[model samples]
Target: MASVLDAGPFFHGTVAALQAGDLLTAGYRSNYRPDIVMNHIYFTALVDGAGLAAELAAELVKGVAEPHVYEVEPTGPFENDPNVTDKKFPGNPTRSYRSVAPLRVVREIADWTRLTPEALQMWRERLSALSANPDARIIN
Candidate 1:
């Protein structure tokens, strides 16, 4: 099962978020081996928040997404440009934004959101069964 360590070791909020996101993503990836399908019980433990964790989990299921980069628009006129003198010239202002693109993993996220207490118990039981006997198929 996943564990949540104390956040005190990290002082900054951004750092904590990055660390959390990275660790969560990496941990999820590590479990998808050919011989083993990780049970929901462990996933439940790793989830920090119902919505957020579900979203992140879904992405992990789809594998890593490509990074996106955008170009920032120029604020001031360029010194070498003849357009600088053109009063009619409109500034080509642009801003760059990025997101974890290609969120195909979102499909897996539904499992967490749809989970009820009973479902959680079932997951725990399945995990226990799997642990007790790796060769046993707990689910069809």
Candidate 2:
């Protein structure tokens, strides 16, 4: 059996409009690295982290969606996300995880913090620079 890594009132951030009981699965294109399709569905224990993700996702897609954070429950096993765990933010400070199984949406978190205009611009520039570099990797 797969070991339990976290007992979470986990949250997923995205631009996709979803309701309670909606399932989020892998195989969707990544919000950070738009060039690749992610094999695992990513979530975080932090509400702000999820909000950040939702912001990036919404902005990166260029108005295709509005930011939304949803409380979620993983259907099966999950593991720490290497991209942000030891590799980027050591010791999982981000409290981020990924799973191949579907995540069930519990409800929308309506009050997560949204980025200020300056912060949003900073991220926009940062993402542009990261995508420009061939060395920038998403441990996919």
Candidate 3:
């Protein structure tokens, strides 16, 4: 069984959708499809923790202080196993987005594990360095 901590935080909204589409098509270099739902995005950065995840989500959508967050659990071996080869899509290229398992919302985000002030600051610095749009705000 996968623990709650194993799952990474995610954001579901218009901003996420756009970012997800960009990640799938541009980042992953996958073929675009009309059926793709471009309305939500998810991040699997366990190192950053939930607080950073929420902040990143909020940055995408202007005026939204706290976006709805969820935890995604891996259901099967294929999804649970780490990407050792660094392949964008494991089994089927067409089903790249299908790797994710079911998602459960975190009603009390404060109760869940969060990043410390120092950790958040470090992550912000690292993210800023890695971000393409340096001018864009990462945290709300």
Candidate that scores best on TM-score: 2
Worst 10 residues of 3 by lDDT: 25-34
- Residue 25, candidate 1: how far off, in angstroms? 5.5
Pairs of residues at least 3 apart in sequence or in different chains that clash in candidate 3: 17-40
Please give each candidate's TM-score.
0.24, 0.94, 0.36
Who is ahead in TM-score, 1 or 3? 3
Q: On residues 1-140, what C-alpha lDDT tens digit does candidate 2 reach at each position? A: 66767777899999999999999999988888888999999999999999999999998777677999999999988899999887876698889999999999999999899999999999889988989999988887
Per-candidate local distance difference test: 0.26, 0.92, 0.35
Determine which window of 10 residues in candidate 1 has minimal summed lDDT.
Answer: 7-16
Displacement of residue 67 (Cα, Å) in model 3 is: 4.6
Question: For candidate 1, lDDT tens digit of each residue in 1-140?
Answer: 43432221111001112311232211122121224442211211122233332333333444343111111111212121121113223441111111122111211221223446576457556545655775643221
Candidate achieving the largest lDDT: 2
Position 43, candidate 3: lDDT = 31
For model 2, what is the alpha-carbon lDDT of residue 138?
Answer: 89
Question: Residue 10 of candidate 1: its Cα lDDT?
Answer: 16
